[model samples]
Target: MSYSIIAAELHKALQDQDTALVETLASELNPADLAQVGHHEPASRMAVLLHCVPLDKRAATLGFLEPQEQLAATAGMPVSELAELVAHMSADERVDYFKQLDRERQQTLLKALPPTVRDDLLKLARHAEGTAGAIMTSAFMAIPAYYSVARAMQTLRLKGADVETIYQVYCIDTSGRFLGTVSLREIILASSENQLAELMTEEVIWVGIDTPQEEVARLIARYDLLALPVLEGERLVGIVTYDDAMDVAEEEATEDMHKGMSIGKIEGGLRSASLLDLYRKRVMWLVLLVFANIFSGAGIAYFEETIEAYIALVFFLPLLVDSGGNAGSQAATLMVRGMATGDVRSRDWARLLGREVFVAAGLGLTMALAVSVVGIFRAGTEIAMVVAMSMVLIVIVGSLIGMILPFILNRLGWDPATASAPLVTSIADASGVLIYFAIATAVLGL
Candidate 1:
């Protein structure tokens, strides 16, 4: 049924304190959709809705919801109850929820959790955010290399239900060094007598615990791995599953998109972010960009005499500057995306610049031609010639500048995405205006 129908029925059942019907309906609904129902409902009501789900499902469903929704649902819930529910959550997710709590609440919850689980939380929390270790789940299947396929299967049967995934079984040596990996298919198809070492792939690919989450995502995507073992030196510590890698990729992509538009990360994302939060995120970039535009203003002032002589120069100004900015933004986007996906690297800066030169030249010529038509119609041959030359020059300069900025930022140990589109566009606009007026003054002798 539709969400509206679900919400209506849920509302009625909640009003009547009809626990049995709520529980029945909750069972039929997917956790994600049920979470959506919680989004529209009041925080008080959201707790009632969460209560309808089975305990194990409740934690999973809560994990599936956004952090804001989770906070709202659990707002006034008892600390002991919250701790118990959080303990049931996946290791990574549990840490995520725990970090969102205040110091006092965190301490209270820490006390409520069993000592073993609290220690696991503390260890995982120590890993720096956006690292493989931080995102990976400690709950993973690692079988001894000496175990026979039959014994391995038995171990997996007993343990698989609790771990993140069982598709890829990690093989560890006696000293707990990571030996290799064996898939469930390998174990199932092989003779029962075959040892895990015989069944496992000897050439295992893995990353160190401190590896960046983005790099982990790239490895998973490149290899099509279900899960990758996270190593602390030679010992297997945890596994970063494909699902977590995908989530990191998506979150990074979203962050990049926001940054590209010159907006910083707004907590709860754009849809749920408060108006004040949205204002803060956008205003910083816009304020900087406004100051950056002063150069354009100065450039115009520098050529005040020329501008007055050919007042028509003012008309095509936006066309000239905007064309360059658009070209620059286009190049920046390609370079940024390539770098983000690991297809491009800092060392490839020269090669990227070489390719971008030819590409920029082609784009510059095409855009120059397109804008020249307007130039010729508006102000005749002299102005048109100036506009065309400026277009070609500015577009080439803008695109090259845009393409190289990311590489420069990356080389300086900064996020390449910080060379954002608006930043490129603003810089391009200022330079393009200078080129346009300078060329006009030279070509027309104005």
Candidate 2:
């Protein structure tokens, strides 16, 4: 059923205090869908909605809520109840939820949690945000290196329910240092008498705890890993599962997209962001671009005599300048996305620039040819020459500027996406004005 219908039913159930119907509805809906329905309810009603779900489902549904909604839904919930909900959560998710609470709430919740869970949450939370350690979960299955395949299988049967994944089991030494990895497939296929160490793949690929989350995602994607082991000085601490890596990839892509549009990093995203928050993220770039356009105006004013002499030059002005801006925006977008995907790098700039110059020249010539026909019909030969020549040079300059700015930003330790469409187009517009008029003055002999 649609979430709107679910929301309606949920609201009615809550109003009638129909505990049986509420539980039935909660069981029928997925945790994510349940969370979506909860989003439609007021904060006061959200806690009640949560309470109607089974305990395990309640924790899973809470995980699906936005951080603010999570806080709102659980507000004034007893510490012991809160602890039980948190305890049911996966290790990584538990740490994330705990970190969202206020300091006092966090302390109380931690104290209410079981000792083992509390220590695990504290260790996971200690890792800096946006690192492998922060996102990795400790709920991974690890077997003793000395265990035989039979023993390992027995261990999985006994303890696998408590772990997140069992497909790729890790092998560790007595001191908990990572020894290697054994896939469940390999273990099941091997003779029961074979030692796990003998059956395991010793060439295990792993990342350090401090690795950037993006790098972790890249590695996981590159290797098609179910989960990548995280280590702290040879000791296995946690595993960054593919699902977590996918989340990092999505967040990074969204952040880059926002930057591509000249919007600053928006906290909590558009739906959750306040009006003022949206304004703050967008206004600075737009206001700066407004001031930047003044340079385009000044370039026009500087060539007032040329414009007056050949007023037809004014006819092609918008067409010519907009062409440059559009071309530049296209180029900037390609370069930005290329750099983001690691398809392009700083060292490749020179080689790419050489190719870009040839490519831009061909593009400029083709555009110049297309516009020259309009130039001839509108204002005859001299103006056509000026317009055509201006198109070629302007396009070439714009394309080069678009292609180079991202590299410059990258080299300066800034995000290459900082070379946004508006920023590139603004610079191109200003340069187009100067290039068009300067070519007009020379070709028209004014």
Candidate 3:
């Protein structure tokens, strides 16, 4: 059934206190779909619905809910039940949920959990947010290098159900230092007499615990890894799975997209964000750009004599300035996307700038040719000459600004995505105004 119809039925079942029907409906949906259904109900109702789900699925369902939604759904539930629910959550997700709790709740939850689970949660939670350690899971399969293929198979049979993934298993030495990795496929195909040390690939690709999550995602994508092992010193700490890296990539992409439009990150995403959240994310950029635009006005005011001498110049102002802004915005978008994907770097700026100059000149000349025809029909030869010259200079200047701003931002230790389209356009508009009038004054002899 469609989630929408299921959601309606679930809501009615919850309203009617039909526990059996709720359980049947909740069971029919997977954890992700069940979370979507929860979105249609109030927090209190969702909490009751969660209790009807099987214990194995309950924690996963809760994990899929937004952090705030999870907290709200669990509010007023008994501490013992909460701990039971938390115990069933994955290691990384447990730490994430634990971090959202207040000190009192955190302490209570920790006290209620098994000592091993509590210690593990605390260890994973201690890593700085936005780092590899924070997102990596301790639930990965790791076996000692001395184990024979037969022994490794026995170990997987005994413990694989508890780990996040059995596809790529890590190998460690006696002292818990990382040795290498052996895939399950290799283990299955090898003779039982062969030791894991022989089967494992010694040349392992890994990251330190403190590595940035963005870098982790990039490495995963670059290498096409299933799971990247994370180390602290020489000891294996955890593994960042492909799924988690995908989440990081999505989040970074969304944040860049928001910054591209000159908007701040909107917490909880757009669907759940309040009107105030939307306003707060967007208002600062709009207000700042308004002030930035004053320079455009000032440039026009400075060219009063030029405009008065040839009133025809006023006709082309919007077209010329807007063309420059559009060109600049296009350049900024390309640079920002290139930097984000690691295809471009700050060191390439000089080479890119040289290429862009040639490219921009070509673009400017072409645009100049197109606009000059309109200029001639509207005014005369002098006006056409002024407009065509302004178009070339303004487009070249605008394109160069767009292409270079991201590199400048990156060199200053800022996110290149912060060199957003709106900001670039504002700067280009102001420069276009100044360049157009200067060319007009020189060409028309105003």
Candidate 4:
């Protein structure tokens, strides 16, 4: 359905005080988009979703909701509803929701779950966050190798409703030992009398529960499979589907973007972030950035005598310094993005730095020449050459600094993205100021 149509219908539903109509309208919308709009009208939206979406779809949609929306919307749901939702939820989403609740709230929620569902939740919840164990979904289609194609189909029809993917079925032994995987298509094409053991392929690519999400995504993408099984020691615990892999990729990218801006754990996207919340995340870094600038000013102030003698330096300072900041920002942004996407890594540092340095030199020279010609008109021949060379030197350093900072931070167990944007710009700004004055005093004979 079109967004405008949904919006118009929703407006009428609100006016008529028809909760059922609101819920009906919500059922037609995609969960992600529905969640986006839901964040806009917390109380009303939550009511629509809670009332409109059936248990399974609601559980799936809840996984896509912003963290704040999850909290507020699920607050009033009955224990039965919560338990049913928990049964259908992915492990990562369940972990995030459970962690948000207070101790009392968590216990109450846990107590509400069915015995089997509660057992799976507790098992998943026990795994530490930010690991393969935490991100995997418990729902998967696994059958013993002895089952015939017909039996497998029966089993799938019975349990596939709750699984992440039924298109790819995993074959295991009676011991719950993973044997291999078989596609539903292949199974369907084969004789119904054929044994699953005969249909199953021997090459089963699986991930250990402790494997990182990156490796999991990479494995899924590389093999181009619909899903990969997660094993605990030997037994299959869960599976990570391609859709889940995509989620991990997108999340890693978004997290890197947040790190670039020094955002400290603000969830639910920018819309849910409060004024105080934003201020809290940004203030500490801004203060450190402010202090860093003092040195830049000090570099200029210390050379006040030089500036007084060569008034020409003061005239061109902004141009040269800003060029450095801009150049550094470019190189830093590229390196940070490349690192995040896995296009570049620690092993490529030397090659990347070498390329950036040469590129920086060429760019610096072009900008310096243009500024020098303009400076000659503004400050005469000697001062123009001094200004040009200062810009050239600073820009080359800026490029090198940009390339190195990200690598160094990554080495120190910090996200390379944290070194981008304001952090790199501020560092370049201070470095540029000193380079500008130093060039004037030494070369212009100030």
Candidate 5:
């Protein structure tokens, strides 16, 4: 059923205080869908509904909720219940949820947990956010390299259900040092008598604990890996799975998308973002762009006499300026996306500039021809020539500026996406005005 239907059912069940019905309905829904269903219910109802689900499902469903919703849904929940939920969560997710709680509350929750679980969570929490160590899950399958294929299969039968993933099993020495990785397929297909060392892939690809989470995602994508091991020196602490990498990829994409449009980073999805948050994220850029536009006004004022001498020039001003802005915005978007995907780098700027120059020349020539016809019909040959020449120069300059600005930002250790389309367009508008007036003065002898 749709989430709305499920939500309606949940609301009715909660109103009637039908505990068994609520548990059955919540159990029928997947964790992700259940999380969405909770969004439609009252926060108080949602809190009661959470108590109906199994602890493992509750933990998974909680991860799907926004931070605000997580807080609301668990308000007034018992510390013992919260500890049970935390224990069921993956290490990375447990740390994330724990960090959101206040220190005194966190201590209470931690104290309720078994000592070993508390220590493991504390160690995972020490990893800085946005690093491999922070995202990796400690609940990974690891077996000694000396175990035979039959023995490995037996171990998996006993422990696989408790771990997050069992597709890729890690091989560790007795000293707790990571030796390599072995796939389940290899173990199943190998002779039963063969040792894990014989079947395992010894050429392990792993990341240091401090490796950036983005780099980890890139590595997983580049290698088509199901999971990557996380190490502190030679000791394996955890493994970052493909699911976590997908989350990082989506988060990074959203952040960059906001930056590309001149909006600052948003804390959560737009559905959860408040009006005040939307305003706060956008107003700074609007204010800055307004000031950046003063230069365009100044450029127009500087050529007052030329404009009066040829009053027809004012008619095409909007068209010329908007065209330049549009061209620059397109170029800036391409550069930002290229940088984000690692398709283009700082050293490739020269090649990118050359390619943009060729492209701009062709686009400018086509547009100039189209505009020059109107210029000829509206005015005369001198004005037509001036308009055509200005189009070519403005387009080339705008495209070049857009193409170069992102590289400059990247080289200076800034986000290339910060060279946003609006910023590029503003810069282009100011420069286009100057180029237009200068060309008009030269061509028409104003």
Candidate 6:
């Protein structure tokens, strides 16, 4: 169920003052849903839910809450309660929760925590946000390669409570260098006498701890993995799960969608962010485009004398230019989306470009013929020829432009989505108008 349903349940339970109902229901819900419920309601109701659930669940569940709710729930938590929560949290989620706290509160939590655990968390937090190191949880299963299957199984059993996943177990040498990986099924299927090194598969792909999360996600998706090993200066640091990588992929998609629509990144969740914030993010692009629109107007005005000489030319000018822009926008949008999702890569540029050119030529010829027929019927033979010629030229030019803009943007280290519908259409509008008027004036000898 959505947060709305949870909120309704909580509100009804609260009015009934049904503590047992609340506790039982909250336990049944997933952390995400619970977090959303806590976010929708205020501090008073939230505290009750927190008190009822097992403290570990409360802490883990709190990780899912918005930054404001996180602060509200934990600001008054006692030293003992808070320490348990921090201890129970996975390293990445712990650091994320700590990051939302102010400096003074952070110090208090650090003071309460054991020095070793505190240091580990602070070290993890030191990584720049949105990197492999930042996203990876320190919770992982590892064993010495020389350890027997029975011993390795024992270690996994002991550590499984702390680690997020137990499927991929990294094997290390005596010096802690990463040696290989073993799956749970291997351990179960292997003879108990065999050492981890003997059973482990050495051909494993891993990412450097410093690798950006985007690249990590790309690699994981490319390789089709359940988990990827993380390295710090050739030493195994941790592992990032495919689940986490999927989250990164979703974020990348969202950012691209924003750019495609000509809006910059929004600071918070789309539903919760303020109207002013949304407007502020979107207005800069609009203002820049407004100034750019003037340049387009200038292109139109440059051929003002020609338009006056051949008054009939103005009638089809908009139609010709707009059609070109629409075609380019369609092509650019498809190419951009393909590139983002890795459906169309730089390597496929040759094939994609060839296909687009053929399609554009065919479309231009067909469109020109249709426009020429319309022109002949609407005006006369002379004007029809002008219209037909301009139409073909504009469409051909627009088609090439549409196919090229995305590639150029990608090569320039900008997102291809930045060459979105509005921007591409705007370019086509300006360029097509210029091509149309220039072709018309020359053909008519005006």
Number of the predicted model whose lDDT against the real structure is largest: 3
lDDT of 6: 0.83
lDDT of each: 0.88, 0.91, 0.92, 0.82, 0.89, 0.83
10 residues in a row with least lDDT, candidate 5: 264-273
lDDT for each residue of candidate 1 in 1-446, tens digit (9 for 90 to 100): 77678767987887788989889878878877788777677777778888889888899888877778778788898988888898899998998888778898889889999898999999888899889999999999999999999999999999989899998899999999999998998899999999999878889889998999999999999999999899999999999999899999999999999888888887765657898888888998899999999999999999999999999999989887888899899989999999998788788988888988888888888988898898889999888888888888999989997999898888889888888999999999999989989998988777
**How do the residues 1-446 of candidate 4 rate in per-residue lDDT, one tens digit apiece?**
79878967876775577888878887777777666666656565565555677776677678888777788887887777776787677766887788777898889888887788778778888876667777887888889999999999899899988777889888989899888989999899999999999988987888899899878887888789788889998899888888878988788778877777777767667877899998998799889889988888888889999988977678788888788878887888899988876788989999988898889889989998898898889989988888888878889988888888999999999878888677887888889988888877888676
TM-score of candidate 6 relative to the true fold = 0.88
Return the TM-score for each candidate structure.
0.94, 0.95, 0.95, 0.92, 0.95, 0.88
Q: Rank the candidates by lDDT, best first.
A: 3, 2, 5, 1, 6, 4
- Expressed as tens digits, the lDDT of each residue in 1-446 for candidate 2 is 77678778978887787877888877779898888887777776778878888898899899888888888889979999999999999899899899888899998898899999999999999999999999999999999989989999999999999998999999999999899999999999999999998988889889999999999999999899999999999999999999999999998999988998999887655767898889999999999999999999999999999999899999999999888888888889999999887889889999989988888889889999999999899999999999889998888888988999999999999999999989999999999999999999988788
Q: Distance from true position, residue 32, model 4, in Å? A: 3.6
What clash count does candidate 3 reach? 0
Question: Model 3 scores what on Cα lDDT?
Answer: 0.92
Query: Which runs of model 3 end up more than 4 angstroms from their true locations?
Result: 2-4, 11-17, 274-276
How far does residue 140 in candidate 2 sit from its true spot (Å)? 0.6
Give model 4's TM-score versus the native structure: 0.92
In model 6, what is the error at residue 278, expressed in angstroms?
Answer: 2.3
Predicted candidate 6 versus true structure: per-residue lDDT over 130-176, tens digit per residue = 78998887778888999999998898888887787898889998888
Q: After superposition, how far is residue 147 of candidate 3 from its true place, in Å?
A: 0.6
**Weakest ten-residue segment in model 3 by summed lDDT:** 265-274
lDDT per residue, candidate 5, 1-446, as tens digits?
A: 77678778887998898999999889888898888887767778878778899888988988888777787788788998888888887777888888888899888998899898899999999899899999998999999999999999999999999887999999999998999998999888999999999878888889999999999999999899999999999999999999999999999888888998899877757867899999999999999999999999999999999999999988788888888888988999899888888898889999888999999988898999999999999988888888888898899989988899999999999999999889999999999999999999887876
